[model samples]
Target: MKTLTALFTAAALALGANAAFAKDVQPDEVVKLVNAKTIKSLDELKAAAVAKHPGSTVTDSELEDEYGRYIYKVELRDTQNVEWDVALDAKTGEVLKDERDN
Candidate 1:
């Protein structure tokens, strides 16, 4: 009985540690994802963009401040290897800006 209790305690502690490491995204920020059809995480957002524009692959992804709003910057290259940038609301997954790379 004591061994079982100890094992459970250790497992709970490990789970708590993992939770602490997880990103704590706010509810209002995550609510913006409701508009997107198939996007939940930053990676998913990039994949959706590539899927929309075939032959394109993500080249760079970063968090940037634009016009007083925090956004995720995603750069992709098409089959021709032409590059473009897509900016998304970091919290809500909404597209804020889309422009071809010059």
Candidate 2:
């Protein structure tokens, strides 16, 4: 137990400011943006990506605030086992970039 605690302490120290917050987050930023109707929901963004490549499985996803613009980034694995990287405008649900990942 002590070893585990020490490891967690070391990891948290290494992360510095990136470590977990001291205060509890009230509302998720993404949820707040979607609720305010300023940006689309994650479901909408995921649907848009899947629409481009039917039968693909979303392997990973993330929402990023880039230059004040919200971007939904998705990684997909298609039926053919090809990996894809897809980026969308979170507000407009527009496909910003979609290409096979090497």
Candidate 3:
């Protein structure tokens, strides 16, 4: 039983480590995702958001394929301690998921 438990623990750790790397996004697909939405450019999104919400900053973003569509992962926070994790549609500029950060 002790040996079995040790093997199980090792397996779990191995799985956890493998999950750490971020998934790859093909360059062409990424452009299609952004262009289809009429986003034009990443700088445009940043500028618009900053203008709307002063003091808030977008820290990081990534494009991912999910549910047969592209999703943009956006993370931001403001002086008021408001944290935002939003997933926007790559083809439509629609908000797919918006959650308040804990």
Candidate 4:
């Protein structure tokens, strides 16, 4: 009985953690936010990233809410094959973090 209770508690904790981490922004919601000026367009955000890392190719991107603030995370690869991770403030199109992905 004790083992079963421990298993259930562990499962509950795992599920709760998964739920907290998997809160993804849906496509339509993103569109609505852009329309309402709550966030910058993806194209503009990408442009800002490219401007900072000239000649780099965008590898991956995601829009997420971190610490209750919307942010756009972009990954890039440069001519020298260096990987970069860039985070931008989705609302104001401000670059928050730009660092190598080593």
Order the numbered candidates by TM-score, best leading: 4, 2, 3, 1
Clash pairs for candidate 1: none
- Give the residue spans of candidate 2 off by over 4 A: 1-27
Worst ten in a row by lDDT for model 2: 18-27
* lDDT string, candidate 3, 1-102, tens digits: 999999999999998876554354677765764677533355655544444446888987876655455556778787797987776665556666667778
Error of 4 at 72 (Å): 0.1
Better of 1 and 4 by lDDT: 4
Off by over 4 Å in 4: 1-22
Q: Which pairs of residues have clashing backbones in candidate 3?
A: none
- lDDT for 17 (candidate 3): 75
Question: Which structure among the candidates has the greatest TM-score?
Answer: 4
Cα lDDT of all candidates, in order? 0.69, 0.85, 0.66, 0.89
RMSD versus native structure for model 1: 12.4
| C-alpha TM-score for every candidate | 0.51, 0.73, 0.56, 0.76
1-102, model 4: which lDDT tens digit per residue? 999999999999998886586355788989998999999999999989988889999999988876568888899999999999998998898999999999
- Candidate 1 lDDT, tens digit per residue, 1-102? 999999999999998886555344354554564356323576766766676568898998765444445566789899987888887776567777778999
Query: Global lDDT for candidate 4?
Result: 0.89
Q: For candidate 3, what is the lDDT?
A: 0.66
The 10-residue segment with the lowest total lDDT in model 3: 44-53
Q: Report the error of model 4 at residue 76, Å.
A: 0.3
